[model samples]
Target chain A: MRRLWIGLTYAVFALLIVVPLVKIATGSLEDGVSGLLDALLRPEALHALMMTGIIVVFVTLINTVFGVMLAIYLVRAAWLHPRIKGLLNSIVDLPYAVSPVIGGLMIVLLVGPDTALGALLEGAGIKIVYALPGMVIATLFVTFPLMVREVMPVLQEIGSQQEEAATMLGAYSWYTFWKVTWPSIRWGVIYGVVLTVARTLGEFGAVLVVSGNIMNLTQTATTLVYQDVENFNVVAANGVALVLAAFSVGLLLLMEWAKKRKEVH
Target chain B: MHIEVKGLSKSFGDFKAVQDVSFGIKKGHLIGLLGPSGGGKTSILRMLAGLEAPTAGDILFHGKRVNDLPPQERGIGFVFQNYALFKHMTVFENVAFGLKVKKLPKDAIRERVQSLIELTGLKGFEHRYPAQLSGGQRQRVAFARALAPEPQLLLLDEPFAAIDAKIRSELRTWLKEMIERVGITSIFVTHDQDEAIEVADEIMIISKGRLEQKGTPWEIYKNPETQFVAEFIGESTTVDNVAALHGFEEAAAWTGTRGLIRPEYIEIGKPGEITLASATMRGVVRHIHFRGSEWMVELEIGDIRLITYRSLEKDVLKPGDPVDILIHRAYLFNESDSWIMENKLKVDPMPVII
Candidate 1:
C-alpha cells in the first residue's frame, strides 16, 4: 500500500511537473532550434526578458535590505511596544492574503495615470503606471513578505543572546549586528533573496496590471508569454516559458543548497 | 572594580522580575546569584551587565553611575546560559571578536586570542566552529570570548546549565579556579544550590523577586536567617513539631512549632554502636536506601518520620530495628524569625554566628 501511494505520488509529479517541463522544452525546439532562437532573438522577447531581469534585480535588492531590517525590527526591537509590533507582524502576510491581481488593482486604483497623484507625477515628468518603477513596486508588493518570513524565524531562534554577549565584550550595536547577528541569519537572507527573485520572475498579474502591460516598456517575460498566447503565438510562448522555467529550476536547486547549509548550524 | 547595585528593580509589563534588589561586590569576589527559576537572578545579572535596563534604581561601577552606559562601554564580560558561542565563527575568531571590535593591533589580537584559547585549554581547536564543539567545549569558547577584551568585571547566567551532569561539576570547578586565577570580580546566576555553593565565594539567595540572603556558603548553610533560606538552601526537611524530638524537647533555644532538619545534622547508628548515655533518642528504622557514598536511613520516633544519613562503612541495619539518633542542630522558625536550635544532649550549646 505504501509502495502504491509512493508510485502514485511520483506519477502525479511527473504528470504535473516533469511532463509539462519536457513538453515546453521540446515545443520550444519545434523547428530544430530555430524556433527557440527566433523567438528569443525577437526584439520584443529580448526587451521583455530584460525588463523582467531588471525588476527581479530591483525587487530582490530592495526587498532583501528592507525585509531583513523589518525582520530585525519585528523580532529584536525592545523599544517597540509589543502590541504595535504584533499588529505590524500580523500585517506582514497581507501580500499573501490578497491575490496578486487584486494587489495590482489596488495599486492601480491608488496611483494609476488617471489618479490625481499619478497625473501630478506625470506633470512632473515622471511616469510610473506604465514604467519600470511601477513594475518594480508591483513585484515588490508581491514578494515583500518572502525575505521577512525567512529571516524572522532565524532571528528569533538565535535570539539576542550572542548580540548581548558581543555588547558585553565591548562591541557596539552595529558592530554586534555585523559580527553576531548577520552571520547567523545570512543563509536565511539568501533563501529570502532567492524566493524573492523567483517570485519576481514569475510575477505576471500584478506587474501586468500595474505597468499597464506596455510592450517594450513594461512587458515582463511572464507578461510577454501571456501576450504571445493571446496573439495565438504558442511556440514563442513556449520558448519564453521554457526560459523562465529553467531559471526557476536553477533557483530551486539554489534553495535546496541553502536549506542544507541552513541546517548545518 | 567594585560594583554596586542600588535598589535595582525590573518589571516585564506587569510581571516584576526583579524587585528592589540591592547588593555590593567587593573587588575580586566571586558572587553567585542563586535562586529558583523565574526568581529574578538573571534579570539582576543583566542589569549589572547593562544588558537589561533597570525599571528603577541605579548601577554603579567603581562608584560611578553606569545606568546610562551602554553594555559596550560597561567594561564587563558576560556568558549566556547556553554559552551563545557564535556558530558561524571559528573558536579563534570567536575569541578575537571583541579585540576586532575594539580595532586592536592585529598582532595584539592574535596574541590575546591565542593566549585565551590556550588558557581555555582549546589550543588545537582554534579553527573549529561552535557546531563542531561539545557543550563543554562551547562553554569554554564562550568563556574565552568573554575574557578576550580583558574586562574588569564578568557576569554569567547559568553558565553550567547547558552541560550534562558529568561535565557540569567539572566545569564548575574549572570556572571557579579560572576566575580566581584571573582575579576578576564576577557574578553568576544559577538555580542549582550545589553549583552555587561549589563555585561562588558568596551566594545570594533569591526568591519571589527578592534578595532573601547573601553570605558565604558556610555562612548561609549554618546561619540561615529566614524560613525560606533554611528550607531552600540544602537537603532540609521541614518538621511540624520539633519539640517532640529527643534532646530538643526541653531546649530553650526553640520558640516555634516549625523546624527544618538537614541530613548532615542527624547521625544514625546501630543499637550496639551507641553509648546508652548518648542514645537518648531511640528510633525505629522505617526504610533504608543506598545513597551514593552513604546509606539513607529513614527512622521514626513515635509517629514522626525523619531522614538521616549513615556512612556506608557502618554496620547495615534492616527495617523495624531500633537505632540511635543524634541530631546536632535544626533550624527552628516562627512566623517572623528563624534560629538554630542545638541538641542539648549531644554537644555544648555555642552561640551561632554569621
Candidate 2:
C-alpha cells in the first residue's frame, strides 16, 4: 500500500510536467509531421530562431567571462571581508527569487526612462528596454548563477597548490594560470557554458516582459511560443516548444558526455 | 653552493613556528635537519628555498642575500613530503616539466630529462604515471624532477616517510650515494634519528623551533648537548643517584651535574678492592631481550631499574639471575646532572670510539 501511494504521488508529479509536453508534441504532429517542420522553416519562425540563438550566444559569452573572473577572484582573494563576499555571492541568486515580471519591472524602473542612469544611457543612443540589449540583459540576469555555481566548486577543489607549484617552476602568474590552472578546470568551465547556453535559449518570463514581445524585431522563440498559445495556435506553439526542448536536451547530453570523458581520462 | 641563514623567523598569527633560527651549510655537504614533529625544520627549509618569507632575517647564497628572491629565481630544488608528482603527467613529462618551464632547447630538455631519469633509476618506467608506481618509485620520479633543473641546493622534506621500513632503508642507502655522487648541497628533514645518522655529513637537531645541537652523527650520539638531544639521538639508560666518588670530582665540576654510564661502558667483572662501590643492593632480573648480536638485560637494581647489553659470545643472562655489574667507564657530571667527561679508569678510548 505504501509503494502504491508513493508511485501514485510520483506519477502525478511526473504527469503534471510531462502531459503538457506530450500534448504539445502530439498536437504539432497531428496535421502530418511535415507541417510542423515547414512551420519551423518559415521565414518568420526562422528569424525568431536566429534571434534566440544570438541571445543565447551573447548572454553565454558575457556570463562566461564574468563568472570565471568572479570564481577566481573569490578563491584567490581570501583577504576580502567575509561579509562582503557573502553579500556578493547571495546577490548572484537574486534573480531566482524575484518574479520574472518583478525583475523586468525593476530593470525598467532603473534603466527604462525615469532613472538618471537610464536617461544617461538613453542620451548616449543606447536603447536598453524593449530592444535586443534589453533581451540580453534579462537573459544575463537569469543565467548568471549557472556558470558561477559550476565553476566555483571546481576552483575550490583544485585549490592554490598547483598554481603555487607553477609559480615556483618559474612561470609568471598568467602563464601558470593558462598552462596549469586552466587545464584542470577546462571541462568545468565548458559545462558551465553549456548550462548558460541552455538557460539563455529557454529563458521566457523575464525576456517576455523586457523585450515587449516585438514581432520580427525582438520576439524570441519563447516569447513567440507564448504569443502562439495566447492566439490559440496550439500547433505552432507546440512546434516552437519542441525545438527549445530538443536544444536543451542536446546541450545537457553534451555536458554529460564531457563529464564522462573527464572521468575516463 | 654554500647557504647561510641568519635570524630567520616565521609566525602564524599569534604563534611563532620558527624563531631566530640561524645556521649555515658547507658547499656540497648532505645535511640532515633532524627534529621531532612540529620542530619547524620544514619551515626553515622553505625559507631558504624562498617559498616562504621570513618575518625578520636574511638568507645568503654564496655571500649574496636572497631574501627577496622567488623560489624559481633562488635556484633551489624542493621535494615535498608526499613527493608532489604531477598526477596528470607521465614520468618523462614530469621530469621534463622544469626544463620546459625554463624554455630550454628541445634536444637539451630531452637529454637532461633522460639523464635525470637514468640517474634516479627510473629508465624503464618513463611512460608510467605517478599513481601507477610504488611509493619508492614515485619518490625516485620526484627526485628526478627536482634534480632535472640542476638546482644549487636540494631540499627534501621527509623524503622516505611514505615508504615501508625495508624499502625506506634501501632507498636511503641509494639516495645517500646518489646525492654524494652529484655533490649538490642537500638538506633533508626527518624525525627519524637513525636516518639522520646514516645519511647526513652533519645533523642539525631542532627542538621546538630552535636549534638544539649541530654536529656530526657520531659526535651527536656519543656527546649530546641537551637532555632532549640525549634522549632523541639514541637508546640510553638513565640512572639516578649512583653515589658520587672523590676521584670523579674534577670531571663532575666540568659537567656541573651528576654522572651517567652508557650501557656498553658498564662491564661485568669479579669484585675487586679498587671497585668504587660493591654491587651489594640487587634485585631480581626483570627481562632479557635478544637484540640480534647482543642481549639487552634489564635488572631491578635496588629501587631503580637499569638496562645494559651483554655480548652474544658471553653466557646469555636470563631473567631471575643475580649478576655482578661494574661501571668500567662512566660519564661524570656536576650537581646539575649534565653529561661531563668520561671517567676513564685507565681503559683505552679506542674501543668506545669505534
Candidate 3:
C-alpha cells in the first residue's frame, strides 16, 4: 500500500514538473546541434550572454555583502525599536511581491533623464536609465531580498551566545564574528548566492525595461530570446532558451548540494 | 587575580535586573552565585566577564579599574550553560582559537593546545567536532578552550544545568577538581542548592536582583542572614505572627515578625510529659514520606503545616496520630525582613496560656 502511494505521488510530480521541463528541452533542440551552436556563438548572442554574466556577478558581490550586513543588524541591533525592526523585516519581503516591471518603472521615475537627481547624475557624466547602470540597478532591486531572507532565519536560530562566548575568550568583536558567527551562517550565504545568481540570470522584464534591449549593447540572454522570437527566428530563440534552461537545472542541483552540506555541518 | 565589583547595577528600560550589588573575590577561590531563576545571577556573571556593561558601577581587577575595558582586554574566560562549543571546529581547533588570536608562536600554540586537550581528558577526541561529543564531553571542551588562554578570572553560567542528572553530580566533582588545578579565580551561577553547596568554596546568594548574603557553604547553609536566604539555602518553614500562632498574646511585641524554623530542629514526642522541650505545640500527623535514609513527617496545627525529618532507625509515625511538637531553636525576623537576633533561639513553653 505504501509503495502504491509513493508511486502515485511520484507520477503526479513527474506529470507536473518533469513533463513540462522535457517538452521545453526538446522544443529548444528541434534544430540540429550545430545550428544551435551557430546561434549561441553569434556575436549578438555571445554579447547578450556575457552581459547577463556581468550583471549577475556585480549583483551577487554587492548584495552578498550588503544583504548579510542587513540581516545581522536586523537580528543583533538591540537599540532598534521593535516596531522599526518589524517594519524593516517586512520591507525585505517587498521585492518578492512587487512586479519586476513595476520595480524597473520605479527606478526610472527616480533616476530618469527628466528628474532632478537624474539631471545631476547626467551632469556628472553618468547615464542611468537606458544604460548598463540602470540594468544592474533593476536586477539588484529584484534579488536583494533573496540573500537576506535566507540568512536571517539561520542567524536567528544560532543566536548570539556563540559570539558572546568568543568575546569572553579574549577575542575582538571582529575576530569573534569571523571565527564564530561566520561558520554558522556560511551555508545560508551560499544558498542565498545561488538563488541570487539564478534569479539574475533569468531576469527579463525589469532588465528589458531598463536596458531598452538595444541589440548587443545591453540586451541579455532573456532579452535576446525575446528579440529572436520577435524577428520570427524560432531556432535561434530556442537555442538561448535551452542554455538558460540548462543553467537553471544546474542551479537547482547546486541548491540541493548546499542543503545537504548545511545538514552535515 | 582577585576581583571586585562596586555598586554594579544593570537596567533594561523600565526593569532593573541587577541592583547596586557589590562583592569581592579572593584570588583562586571558586565561588558560586546561588539564586532562583531571574535573580540576576547571570547578569552579574556577564558584567564580570565584560559581556554585559553595567548601567552604574565599577569593576576592578586586582585593584585596577577595568570598567571601561572590552571583553578581550579584560582577559576573562566564560563557559556557557549549553557549553557553546564551536559546532564547526574540531576540539583541537576550538582550544587553539584564543592562542591563534593572541598570535602565539605556532609551535607553542600546538604544545599548549595538545596539553590542554590531554588535561581535559579529551585526548583521542581532539579530531571530533562538538556535535559528535556527549554533553559531558562538550562541557569539558568548553572548559579547556576557555582555560587555554590562561585567563586571569573565569566565569561559568550554570555549567552543569544541561547535563543528565546522573552525570551532573559526577561532572560537579570533576569541575571542582579542574578549577583547583587551574588555580584561576572562578565564579559559577546555579539555582541548585546542592550543586552550589558541593562545588563552591564560598556561596553568594541573591534574590530578585539584590545580594542577600555572602559566606562559606557551611555558614550560608547553617546561618543564612536573611529570611530569603534562610529558606532558599535549605528546607525551612516560616510562621507569620508567631505570638498569634502559639496563642501567646502577652508576647504581642513579636506580632509582625516571622519565626523561621528548620525541619531538623522540630521533633515529635509524647503529649503529657515535657522534657528538654523549649517550645511545644499539639498537631496531628498528616503524612509520612520516605526520603532516602530518613522519613519526613508532616504535621498540621490549626492552619500551619510543618515538616520534620526523622531518622529511619526511629519508630515510624503514621497519619492522624496526635503528637506534641518540639522546636529547639528558631530565627526571628522583623517587619523590615532583617534578622532580629535578640528574639532568636528562644521559645517559651505554652503553660496552658490559651
- Highest TM-score scorer: 3
**B209 Cα displacement, candidate 3 (Å):** 1.3
What is candidate 1's lDDT per residue for A121-205, written digit by digit as tens? 9899988888898888888989999999999999999998888788787878788888789888989999898899999899988
TM, every model: 0.91, 0.84, 0.93
lDDT of 2 by residue, A1-265 (tens): 9999999999998798778778878888877788898768777788899999999889988999999889888767656777788888888888888877777777877788678988999899998988888889888888888888877888788667556655556667777777777877788888889888988887888888888888888899998888888989878888988999888779989989878755553
- Candidate 2 runs further than 4 Å off: A1-20, A37-48, A73-112, A127-141, A152-162, A205-219, B237-284, B290-294, B318-320, B323-338, B341-354
Q: Write the per-residue lDDT of candidate 2 for residues B1-354, one digit (tens) a residue.
A: 998889888886677888888898999999999999998999898888777788888899999999988777878777888887777779998888778889999999999988888889898999998889999999899888888888888899999999999899999999999999998999999999999999999999988888888999999878878777776777666655544432343553353355566677656522232344342333457898988888888866566566778778777667877766555544544445555454443343343444
Count of backbone collisions within predicted model 1? 0
Residue pairs clashing, model 1: none
Write the number of the candidate with greater lDDT, choosing between 1 and 3. Answer: 1
In candidate 3, list every pair of residues with a backbone clash.
Answer: none
Every model's DockQ, to 2 decimals? 0.78, 0.40, 0.79
For model 1, what TM-score is found for chain B?
A: 0.93
User: Best candidate, DockQ-wise?
Assistant: 3
Better of 1 and 3 by DockQ: 3
Off by over 4 Å in 3: A1-24, B244-251, B271-274, B277-279, B340-354
Of the pair 2 and 3, which is ahead by TM-score? 3
